[model samples]
Target chain A: MKYNAAFNPSGGAAIVGLGMTEMTREYSYSATGLAGIAVKRALDDAGLKKEDIDGLFINAGVTNAISTPLQTSLGFRDLKLLNHMNAAGSTAGQMVQFASLAIQAGMASHVVCVFADDPLKPGTSAGAAYGGTSNRSTGMASLPASYGFFSGANTSYALAARRHMGLYGTTQDQLGAIAVSTRAWATMNPAAMQQKPMTLDDYHGSRWIVEPFHLLDCTLVSNGAVAVIVTASDRARDLKQPPVYIAGMGQGHPGNPRQAGYENEVNTGARIARDTAYSMAGVGPDDIDIRELYDCYTYTTLVTLEDYGFCEKGEGGAFVEDGKLGPGGSHPTNTGGGQLSGYYMWGMTPVSEAVIQTRGQGGERQVQTRDHVLVSTQGGILDWHSTLILSPNADAGTRN
Target chain B: MTNQDQAVRPAPIVDESSKPFFDAAADAVLLLQRCNICHAYLWPFREICTECLSTDLSWAPSTGKGSVHSFVIMHRLFHPAFQEDVPYNLTVVQLDEGPRVTSIIRGTANEDIHVGMSVSANWHDVNGTPLLHFEAF
Candidate 1:
């Protein structure tokens, strides 16, 4: 659903708590088990009890029927709101928007948004497990599979990276800048998976998963989960942790699958979503203090930088050069190492990182100004996208 | 060999909407659906026009010539049948008629393939199933 702040123009709802389980290469637990751990951690961090949670929003695609099992485990007898979303990786931000709507409408007082998955676990179907699976029996999969295009994201995104290079002279080195910078942040973050500092030489020498993409350019398939708590901005002030206001948010999808599925390397739904989010937040790109972009691939961040108006179209390559996104750089992006170096909780990785930054919990990698944080999440080869602007102040409106 | 035993690669599962496209591909012709009313080309198989939302559509033969819009050399195998073709290049061909189609770029090394390179349609037979592919023009 489209997010209209006019219903509660003063930013009524805010995220008061953020938590996560250990982000490791492999976690030995059921998907539900991990989700429960994350939910409890978020509640504990918020200093709230299980009974205080009246609503639950979860990443439905991770585990089937997660709400009932989680609610039962947490000892909540009744829930005023429940949602299970399957928008690939974009569900994290979408769930937050849904939870905020519930609180504003009085359907629930406290809502928990959670994402837990074990894509790297044993005995899992390789392609169908992640965002790149095709039906093989219908739609876009039939034609592509005939040509041996059966793998997930690595191929689809590599094609996009190559298209960008061909059209705008984006070089492989420019893409390496993103990987190198994210790894620099990961060195400071204790929870990151790929902890060893990655240099430009290491990025170039990494295994070539696809022509334009190196192994390091891709996100680590670590098994982990992250969760956050959402409640009214007024109620949040009385809670334990400081409130991170949901200043503005928006979700966008190409009107038709044909547009999203065909010739999609050049454009995506993020272009439309970013415009709405910035307009609603009353802030321009210059006003954003930091960015927590969904980094499924190095090129995804590059294209998002252009689509979100951080820089002009076809200039993201040049824009990211010279360690611009590093710790001491002007634009501090993905403060928590992001999915590329940190654990891959799909879209939740970016959301969790942004929440931590906005809460001033990002110890070493925190941006100087944690006031206006912009987070972007995407699903289905940029087919679906959502942008969220967060702040530490309840009324963080940039209208001046 | 029986159908199941002879299948070495994933074959297109034909349904009511996509049967014609596969049928034409098997005969060494590339067919793209065009809305008879809006005159817009549609990919994969759609019953109605995406542009103007018209149901009047017809199967039209394409020249099957286009430039390489983008491509990837898939080093990882997602399916058992693709193990033999590991490190093969899959390219998206921007057809001159306006729709983009995915096909394996044959007759060239994966490292040599470049975007915007001209390619023409050809047929690749896999376990008796014929499919469309492209070769350097």
Candidate 2:
């Protein structure tokens, strides 16, 4: 009994609206200002009012830690079903999963999934994320920290890259291609952070921050918010625009925090999540025109090609070369530029891209031909990953 | 609470869940692994036993004996904070009690560290606190 999004599929739930605020490193507005802008735009896109909303999904950072109802914040007294999930960065994908489950369960008529930041307030530091330093450790700071094996996210990635380079013989150029293609994709996106086209030489010439990984391989954090609205598929047809049917979605935690980011789980995890989505949408990986794996870093996208079953393990390094993940290639990942160049709301862009691809509205960055696109969500440093399958129409899994 | 000194700040510190280990480290006697079901040797201290998974674990003294299971030279510094310690030795020493303890292989160059070599624990007290480092037997 394969669970399809149509049979047990979340057919009723559809993303009817989307919204986002500008990404800025400096504080132009408070996090609430960014969150309000995004939430307001999503409501506007859905053609719905503040009082019309029944549920809210809020994430916290400098721009977003507060979990308040829309009515309370915007001067209304009639909002219900508030859901707050705090993931490191994969808040967007996590919110979608929560919303889908809530909507499918008939808990809310309208669900708003949001990612906003308030984590960067003045008089405060980047906290534990700068390093693997967590407030929740009783194991006595070990050699990994005392020896400085991992002082920050950059160093942690460096440690993992060393192992990956040692194990799979992944080349520096292969890593650069991941950065290059994302920057190329970012060139097509107007709202992207770094939209300039970069060459392989440019990537090589870039300053090497950590060993193997250069400056281009890292993600930039900004103060902003991105939001989406979901309603049942039944109401999707009656909405102001076409709906991108919720095909399949799943999430997972990493077995090893230190080594999880390099697991290349895209093949195993994405395969299962996709099988469910394809099982629901009645399509397969061959039917996909786009592949959006959560790419917080360059190696992330590189390792997942094999993880997503696009190629065999140890082949992702080679398969990524020569315009493979590029626009003309079979799979175009990070079309919205990815975290490397685009707005990274924790796999948010890919979710929006899936909607855009299915609706055939990804202006300038649209794939020539596509259907049953798979969107992946990351939990943190690849410590966890999730998958969601989307399509233009309803796909109920047929009993074989 | 206030740091007025440039080199160091003199402030009374408080401890909640980690006072005992600190005191034991002050004694230079490493005690981490614990057995709830049966009293035995342990290296890495935890509330639950890896052997029994029982929540009843108490830290005890160790003989400070182990062997190197695997090691990495790390020609590159893992942290800018430890830049002076570049090319540091990192190893997974399988304790005599069977718990693998991870630590820096000090008093030896990176190339000098080898697998299956006999090793003993050496706790380097930093800031009046013992930070675990190891030496070859």
Candidate 3:
């Protein structure tokens, strides 16, 4: 129940394991099968038996929200310790943190956090839905008497970006810079959806999915699952690898999904969520060396970096343009090719990279040496969100 | 509210949870937002008004008109269920009463649309009652 201000988690409740199925939308396997494959792999990585897991945290997939895959996966009949934490879209880092907490709290010896998605509706393109999901359910008719919502993720952010551009004089190239650098990072990540190097010319030349957020600025979507395990900090001490602690956690929902011609950062969920996580971890945005943000949309990552306390509220567009989040940059992100470049597996794949980075396992895109990492998770997976800061020390108190 | 009487006006499938919303949509007039302490004109009827952060909201009428603040054309439908509506245009129109509502844009061609254009309310007779869409003036 107590944590030390300097408690290093290098051997505490670390991620002893990780697993992921290939990213694709055309798979015939059920969502459960996908999760099981990933879960088994995570356990294998942890060097633990399936029975060692005592807690369950599930994100069956965004499209699988109302589905039965969460329970059916793992083929578990004799379920023991289960913590059903459902903050959709914020991330796989949340899952890892959930496992870490279950261990720290003694609720379970080891927790298997499984999330997978066939996010792409079958026969459709191999893609994932960005920050928003169409809320229409069958059998119900839309009210015919007045104006209804026609907005989706792109338009939603466009309004905000337009206001930012209008108020702060933000530019298309500032936005374009993010896409360029993100594409550059994606080339390094084989799993990212867009791996080809993108230039400002390519960014400007790309077709617009929504005005301002052209094809290049958008993130790609795919199908895949990423899972991991966290055991008692004591048990982690003897593991084959080092450990990463859940230093902090945060999640959020926009106060208003639409922009009312005003661009106020606090109205957005980033600062609120970031503050809570920082308070929990005792660290500031300047402390972390790496970030695994949800890049379901280009602005998704750009805006989040600002919201996570990395820079002044409106400065995200400028932050990424400077190459700070690229290879060999001060604070790198999506090293394995984010949803933008790599596969779009419901944004959880980035969390796996966070684990790898914290474990110093990122091969080429790896930070020089990651003693600390901040993993941000989000998407339209429930109109939800969350951020988890992981460290090599478990007992270290807050970082801020 | 009865078994035999159900035949006359079939019991609404939506319960206390969805009745108010369906009722407003059925009426063609959007509902005003209400708070636990004050039942005020909260446009875009919601479960709770952000004003008081209270769940005690009641339905009220809203002036169904606004300007098109923003939009999207959904050039393609991600799911086959929406195939017929492919390339449908969606817009965020701020209502006269203040809530910004988004829905399909009608009464205008995609080529004619532009920022700051004036738009008004046009109910879409989707099925049971009028569903709100938009028209540019």
Candidate 4:
């Protein structure tokens, strides 16, 4: 991967604080309320007052809640930078990237990026909440829906996963390996939603939501918010918590033309995001000690590992079949159970865990090495991707 | 419950740009947008050709033949209109013309559908709405 310029933002910014609301299926608070609480908690965690936050970025969830008005609700005034971001599930990493660039460019001294959502209702099933029948069938959108091709992430991801399976001979058991291993790590983390022990048999026995995707393959839906504070790496050293240096950041959006020759399902945007982040961080996949990947589905984890150069592309099935992503495995992926077994807060699910592991705060599930951590966030049906390479050492990446 | 009590599936919202495609569907013909300049085929009815950005486009009849690029058996009902259609296969067919269309694949069991299976389009009407489906050829 070659670049025209030698400029790199690695080690220019750092995350000094982390805050999160309780992950729950049904909570009383609204999305804005959750964001307010998360922001307050983050400010407290960083030992800074609201006035110290010169920048604010908000990422709303599926409900379209939380926006610039959150600053008024949080009583923030005279901010140098504020915007609402939407890259779907990849917004968390994108927010951090923008905040890092802003701080490095002296646009804002301290920036807070927050994401919150309240998708779970009191009595409705998670499927109903996410797969509501409100999709408009008129116009161009109606063509697919008219054929009973309704809008839902499950169906789209299932199609993608099936294509990968057909092309690479990836088996259901390979996907089961990811679900089982992620559950193993979830059991060790008290914060994880599904802490019960899961096995390959249990995964296979789980009810099928879509063919090629069992219920266990899906992620948990929860109502929660997560926020992080970013500032210059030099100032982060004087903060209340250990600074997790933002070593490298990159985003990729592979437009899906949906043509015959386009293989967006088999090949994702993570490949480009990986190259950009790796080039900026000046490190290869072997240098990272922990992987906090966005596991919206078990298949996503497998494909992401392959795209990030952990293994050859078509060999992800065999790579994960040996249980290498579990608690005591060579690659400690989704150490906090990931979105599959852990709480789902979009990209924040992985970003928050990356911060904890980089700070050496993952109590029971923390990896032995805390030097470098790689975090990935994916949005849409393998359309958008963002990568973040975090480290405890401020001088981790090579400065250009 | 009587047939009248059954929930009617939502109709496709049609506008100026998509009216021609739906009009062609009403005639049981699979029509696709093609650029007059670059001769590129476009799906879902677009004003300009994606290949050459040409507004000079026209609707052309297709052979209605394609292969299953990928598919999924939807076990859970996402909409009430699909209450009786649970466990149906929602398939994406790579049309022989070069574009992909997402529709249901009929005349075959859900387990029988696989990638690269040859299929041909099947048009039907439901609640006064024309829908395009595919069947194993």
Residue A278: error of model 4 in Å? 0.5
lDDT of 3 at A233: 62
Q: Looking at model 1 chain A, which ten-residue stretch has the lowest summed lDDT?
A: A1-10
Q: Chain B TM-score for each model?
A: 0.89, 0.78, 0.70, 0.92
Ranking by TM-score: 4, 1, 2, 3
Tens-digit lDDT string for candidate 3 (A105-124):
55566677777766566555
In candidate 2, how many Å is residue B18 off? 4.9
Higher-ranked by lDDT: 3 or 4: 4
lDDT of 2 by residue, A1-400 (tens): 2111233233446788888888765566665667789888988877777766777877765344557654366553444567667665556677887777776776666778877774445554443335434432344534355554543556545544544555577788988888888888888888888888899999888766555567787776656778888877776666676776676666655443111122432333454455555665566667767887777678777766666677777777888877778776777887778778887666676777677677787788888676567787765545666777766766533311
Ordered list by lDDT, greatest first:
4, 1, 2, 3
Model 1: DockQ vs. true structure: 0.52
Ten-residue stretch with the least lDDT total in model 4 chain B: B1-10
RMSD of 4: 3.9
Q: What is the two-chain DockQ of model 2?
A: 0.19
> Which one is best on DockQ?
4
Task: Give candidate 3 regions above 4 Å deviation.
Answer: A1-12, A65-79, A83-85, A120-122, A126-167, A254-267, A381-383, A393-396, B1-37, B46-70, B73-89, B95-98, B103-137
lDDT by residue (A1-400, candidate 4, tens digit) is 1111112344388898899998998777999999988888998998888878889999999888889999998898888899999999999999999998988777788899999999887777777667655556567766666656654888889899999987899999999999999999999888889999999999999999888899999999999999999988888888899999988888888777777777767788889898889888899999989999989999999999999999998999999999999988999999999999999999999999999999999998889897889999999999999999999987887642
Which of the numbered candidates is closest to the native, going by highest lDDT? 4
Off by over 4 Å in 4: A1-11, B1-3, B9-14, B79-85
Docking class of 1: medium
lDDT for A308 in candidate 3 is 78
Candidates' interface RMSDs, in order? Answer: 2.8, 6.9, 7.4, 1.7
